[model samples]
Target: MNYFELDTPALLIDKEIMMDNLHSMQNYANQYNVQLRPHTKTHKMPKLARLQEELGSAGITVAKVGEAEVMANNGLKNIFIANEIVGKSKVERIRKLAETIDISFGIDNTYQVNQIEEVFEGAEKRAQVLVEIEVGEQRSGIIEENDFRTLLEAVKACKNVEFIGVFSHDGHSYKAQNIDECKELYLESVNRTLHFAKLAEEMGLKPKVVSIGSTPPFMLNFEIPNGVTEIRPGTYIFMDSSQANVIGTYDRCAATVLTTIISKPTKERVITDVGAKGITAQTRSIGHTATKGLGRIKEFDDVHIHGVFDEHAIIYNESFSNQVTIGDKVRIIPNHICPVCNLYEKAYLISEGEVVEEIAVDCRAKLQ
Candidate 1:
């Protein structure tokens, strides 16, 4: 069936463009000599996750234990919960999952280390963990070298927790003023992570994997430091308007929401059937030059979605009045692709404007 036959406000993925984005990211990882573990939280589809692994991803990265469980249940063997996993419930879940596959997670504090040790004690296997280092993102991580060393020491003391190495997000790279600044931030993050990894080795801990990446930094072609062993880049698989604007191109974005015009309230105003529920309410930061609206209409050049209601999108372009009419279908490039994927149950794989496949968002609402 054709894509138009599907209901409005449906998620549509351009198969060709998505394949290019995936291969391009894999090639970038190869150039840096780091294993690519594309984060699955972005797409949340097992098919895409497996495709990424088939295209040379060493493994898959997830933000939540529940997401890791979903992937594991779907036959993904190697999984890394990149975010810090705390709480007895989550720890126990991870311990149980370890029975079937290799499970690992991130830790930045001694509290987490102690908790993991207590939960996984006497299990047949130990949980591999990566120490999260805050290079510049200033997010959740061990920023100070002393604190990092302390966390490493705590992990070493844990009989059931195995130290894998260090990892970082470098999320601040998104705020880079230019491509050069993005490159600088990426390099700084890699260097700082490497410093901590070397520090771990000095303390008699073998830091095997040094991972780092974010969409902006990963797109800049920065050299991954010699000690960095893996890269976790999620958004590169389905570039959004925000990523494209930052990187100065839109050729890589493969996912979009297909909406149809349902209202023409005025000569200069139009409304599409998609709104916050369909495209997400996320907007690009003010620093981005292309920041204008919630999304852009792919079919109408220069047409932007001015605002979004619960179930309606407002488009206020006078030119749109001349080109678009009621019932006309338009593709919307979402402001942020990650949450948009979570908001949908499935995505229609479109090739040449036809629905080629309907892929389930198997990991959707797996919020644990």
Candidate 2:
């Protein structure tokens, strides 16, 4: 059956293109001798996470404890929640997960260390954790050397918590002016993360995994420094409009929103069935990853969604409106694939225009 026959506003993944993306990133990791622990927050589907593990991802990286549990329940044992695990309830959940699988989380302060120490009081194994270094992203990471040492000291003094290694997210690379600036910023961020790893070594806590990632830096194929042990690129599996801008091509973009043209409101105005609730209203607004409009019209060249309402995507392309009728379907390559994925309940896996599988968004609302 034709994909246009499926309900309006469905997510679709091109199987061949998606597989190529998965293999390409894994090959990059293998070439650099680093583990590709892909961030599963991209798709949030256990099936895709398992496929990544089979395709050579060392483990899986998730954003929340709920996602970790979903992946772990699906038999993805080696898991890393790449965000600070706060509160007694979340800490206790980690304690429960630790009992059966190899699980670890991010920490930037001793307060988190102390909390984990209390939660894993009589657990079978010590709570494993990694300290996050603020490597220019200006996010939730320890920026100062003294702060890094202080957090490590707390981990060292802890009776149950075990410091695994240092990690950092160079998200700033997404806004780099060009590929050259992207490479320069990437190296600096890697060096800063490596510096923290060295500090961990000096403090007698030999880090087992020194991880650093953000898709933009890796997409450029900039050389991964020696000290880094793993790369956790999330959106590489399903290239989006923003990432395609960094590379100057959408050939690798496998995910798209399959929507039907609901109405031709005016001579130059077209509306699709999907909107802010579907493709989202996010724009890169900066450097190499900067995108045009809300979403790129996948079937038409130089066409984009002018805007989106709660349930309608506004299009101002007279040429595009002339090309399709009111019921004709079109695909929109989103600016950011991560959040766009969370909105759909399932994705139609297409192979040469035929729906082969229905991949559920298993962790759709696993925000906790």
TM-scores for every candidate against the unseen true structure:
0.97, 0.99
Global CA lDDT of candidate 2, please? 0.93
Give the top-scoring candidate (lDDT). 2
Across 1-368, the per-residue lDDT of candidate 2 in tens digits comes to 76778998999999999999999999999999999999989999999999999999989999999999888898999999999999999999999999999999999988888889998998899999999888888889998899998888888888899999989999999999999999898899999989889988998988899999899878888899898899999999999999999999999999999999989989899999999999999998999888889999998899999999999999998888899998899999999999999999999999999999999899999999
Residue 89: error of model 1 in Å? 0.6
Q: Per-residue lDDT tens digits of candidate 1, residues 128-218?
A: 9998898887789988888888888788788999998888988887777777777787788888888888899999997888888687777
Give per-candidate clash totals.
Answer: 0, 0
The list of candidate 1 runs beyond 4 A from truth reads 288-290
lDDT of each: 0.87, 0.93
- lDDT of model 1 at position 27: 96
Measured by TM-score, the strongest candidate is 2
How far off is model 2, as Cα RMSD? 0.7
